[model samples]
Target: MLSVSWCATAQVFSPGGGTGVWRVFLDPIRPGGPFSVTAEQRIANAVDRIILKDVYFGDVWLCGGQSNMEMTVLQVINASKELTLASHYPYIRLFQAGLNKSLRELNDLAGIAVQWSVPTAEILGKGNFTSFSAVCWLFGRYLYDKLQYPIGLVESCWGGTPIEAWSSQKALSKCNLSFNVTNGDQKHEATGPQEPSVLWNAMIHPLKRMAIKGTIWYQGEANTAWHNAEYNCTFPAMIEDWRKAFHQGSEGSTEIDFPFGFVQLSTYHHRVPDDSFPWIRWHQTADFGYAPNPKMRRTFMAVAMDLGDEKSPYGVIHPRYKQEVAYRLYLGALAIAYGEAGIVFQGPFPKYFQLKNSTELRITYSQELAVLELSKDIFEIRCCTMWNYSSCKWVSAPIVDNFFNILSLSLEQCQQKVSGVRYAWKEWPCNLKKCPLYSKSSKLPAPTFIIPKNDHL
Candidate 1:
């Protein structure tokens, strides 16, 4: 085990652990409450080896993912209100971790002491909010106010990084993921996050068994180079490994299936985008439906299909509308993590499709909702070639039944094969104002997906 030897000069805490503050690594194994350092040893007297004590017994969340997750609170378009408001929450803590590469798993975070400080307002001074993760800070602020508990955020994220970097070697091997970025070109070192297990060893492994409630991920923009089909297996494997890591070490958790939530990819226009980007969104949704373990349903997806910034001719992959993303994550956390009653967490999902006739098909969703304008949001037939696709013209699905929540589509009108039918399957489907479909109960838009197999009538 890798341990750090350091001294402390932070504020002292009261004996009873009242409304106050302390900055030190408290004994994580004690049950009754957070306790002070159990033991300490001097190292040659040159180094003051003291295991400091901190007593913030709140839930910690591992905010892990890539670029989008790295977006700061200052970047939000109308973020002044949030930035100022965030400074008031002293209970909310931030433990910022930087990027590092490792050939083997690491037992501690790289660099200086991993202190839990408020990311906003530096202890009575205005030294926070300059580096807080926008989505994460908002989520934590909301949750802290609601639950009234100390919320610690461990940000283990890197820009343009792929999911494999945060995953364990054992997990990747189990899923047959053998991509080694080290063997590839060395000149592209600054490209970020394609390498596997590097960030996990340096940033994540150090936090193992350091009690966290769950993780909130906002990534997948960088993984377009990897096979999209493989994401269905790789993503879950990563989540499972993280849960295992969180349960290892001295402060391990018994709950294997820790509640995990993620922001589904948003709409964006890139000069040269990956073909598998859209499919990755489908796989994210598919995990909720087809995970090998039923408990994986605890995994929730915050659909950003309606939040893509499409006005820009070139398109904005990183949309400034982080408030909606945070809200959706709030809804997900409220329902999935907190198990709130009478709350709507999920949007409309394809329950199943039934064949009504040879040309027409009936589509039903898991939730019931009023069918709105579909002329722009949805496409009926599959477009094979660009020339044929442009002229093919998408035929919108008409509202069939409000009670059953069905949208009727005609296969004959599309003049394409019946092998595939999907909605908002494009890389930038959210680039439009009118979303494909929405639920009456939740009002959330329909997620992007290609119907598995040929459900042709």
Candidate 2:
């Protein structure tokens, strides 16, 4: 028999026959704590006791995704300063799950790369792609700065893995993908961590029993290469399935519709021109081109189109400026998770577009817009004459007027009626903080978007 107590309440449980494993359920407690937990058991004539000290009851956020989420504090910009400042937040606990994969769901974690511990300079600035995650750490640190309470962050991520690897088979089915596995088949050879449901089985499944506040993800780069088309379905399916799994695992303690936050795919290659990256960004929001939409409710997004890092030592694909990324995510968490009001979590987005005439088109934004005056070719229009329908081409549309929340563009360059319009639709749209459009108050960059011929205004 084992008995556990917390907040002056006691629960008794019996260990199972062979595993000697028992579970104790506790009533919900308020979020701030540096408290302790003790488990006691009695044998024939002796007593065994285990005490866990400095335990916390605050929000526990699971940070998951690819290399961007795996990048450590040391690999980010101003690493030394960030590491030193990490010591100031003793209440922020960090845990990193070791890299592992399984063909079946796991009952417990395979390994813990970094156990729950308070942040330290050395610990924060550990290996390049191991242990502490800069975005996870900074997001928790920012939350602690505001909430002034304990914040637990768990990093369970693998680099270069697609969303399928982290999603369950049920989730994949939503996208019409079949992920099959044979039980007790040790001969199965996994191509890598990218195998579907492997990371979910070995890393995410085990942690489901633990209650979590929400999740912040930085992925979609891997999916950009392949399965990019299914992302709009797969991504939202994964979120829905994870929420269901966690809620059931926690015995309904975790919210069924917990908040989710994700960083839209950032720039990949400055010189390479492709629509894959921009398409993934749009798909990440279920093709809504923004978050918290009908398909993905209670969610938020951080746009990284303008935060391109062309000279990063690690690689241009891995932006070193994770602080800004984390800060933007933190703002979303404030509004979505913490219920903070008057929070400008998202940048200005196009509310609607109107074809003023044959030579002009006007776009109105959700908020007041500001032009950084960085690029002249951010907007493009597809035009094709009746005789040249098969030879349609996209031409640059110059901004004729940008005032308040409305932007007027000249369509005179297109000799024929414009059929499509797109903005910032490139792997690298602009230099860091130099995107042409942004929210005047929040300074957050507008997300990339495209309006097809049928939907063009």
Candidate 3:
């Protein structure tokens, strides 16, 4: 019997006009032709098509977060249209890593790992709710169309999981957080997801070696309602640890410190006096600005403060408008990842505030980032009647200066002395279509913001 044994690892351009060179390891025609290198779990399944000719090279993104990030195509607002359209895009590849928990970090998955799938009507329908991450998909779709690259998305998410579970114990230790599992009150130890670093140990540890462009996250709901205050420190720490862990290896040549983009919690219809979400958003903003690394890529936020479903029952904590959520994320990716100059990815956040007088407060920001459109009634400036959540009501104020891009809020006319001013911070079905505060260049809506009480008259 004669056998060809000319085996060698080679990298070459893909079958179609792909973006980058693909690696081809000739293994006696045993390990199929083309497939995404599994992130968490190495491919442990079989495929019908032995010869995968339609290989492409592009960016692979780790789409990690909670339920919202895990929300599937069938669950999005425009499911039928979105799913129908998803069938057409063949270049976008998805690896839905099945869930498995471990007490310690492992090199590979222990359970049956699902292989990669390129979306089509049949394949997508088969996967159904487990098809792909909606926000991640839409984000990838946008990137694929604009950047014209083969996109791979790693779907790693669990509903109702906290940031604590996703973080590593090493990271938590560095942050100096107390993880005492008590019985009286903090007995969250009873829950497996709350166990410090278990999720990261099990789900994320194996993927440290995988190559990729960056990560897109949509979590923080669980952390908001309780541990809101800690996000300012923990969130940044988690990112830093992730950067070090993923890029950690004997070879220092590989750079894994990648750009991270995440969604700010959408407006919640919390009728109660809970400021958890607001404080969480505040901490998130602070974390981004104050990340430990100065040279690493900066984290970006997709402000969804105005996107929360405001309909009755208040059960719609997870908004169905995934299309816009992804659109906003795309704006960030284009500006940060693709290096498109002059993109207003960051919305008009208050850069500086001045106490002009006793009855007036002034806001200063970059003109390029001023996406606010008063003409469209997208932005609503509210004067707080009391120093409380949702106590502010919409009020008209002069655009003190547009050429200079300054906003002045006059408290003299208010019957109640204004404690603070909020921008697009309504609780009820917020100003979705008419959201006023947006970036002038990127057309991205501004996140909810409130000046400090010290700034008030």
- Candidate that beats the other on TM-score, 1 or 2, i.e. the better one: 2
Residue 209 shift from truth in candidate 2, angstroms: 0.5
Candidate 3 whole-model C-alpha lDDT, 0 to 1 = 0.64
| lDDT of each residue in 163-240, candidate 3, tens digit only | 888888777766676454322333344376656676787778877776667788888888876567778777777887
Work out the TM-score per prediction. Answer: 0.78, 0.95, 0.76
- Please estimate how well model 1 matches the true structure, expressed as its whole-model Cα lDDT: 0.65
Which residue pairs come into collision in candidate 1? 120-128, 120-129, 121-128, 122-127
Candidate whose lDDT is highest? 2
The lDDT per prediction is 0.65, 0.87, 0.64
Is 1 or 2 the stronger prediction by lDDT? 2
- Which residue runs of candidate 2 sit more than 4 Å off their true CA positions? 1-6, 15-20, 183-190, 386-391
Determine which window of 10 residues in candidate 2 has minimal summed lDDT: 182-191
Candidate ordering by TM-score (highest first): 2, 1, 3
Clashing pairs in 3: 370-440, 371-438, 371-439, 371-440, 378-434, 378-435, 378-436, 379-436
Candidate 2 lDDT for residue 183: 49
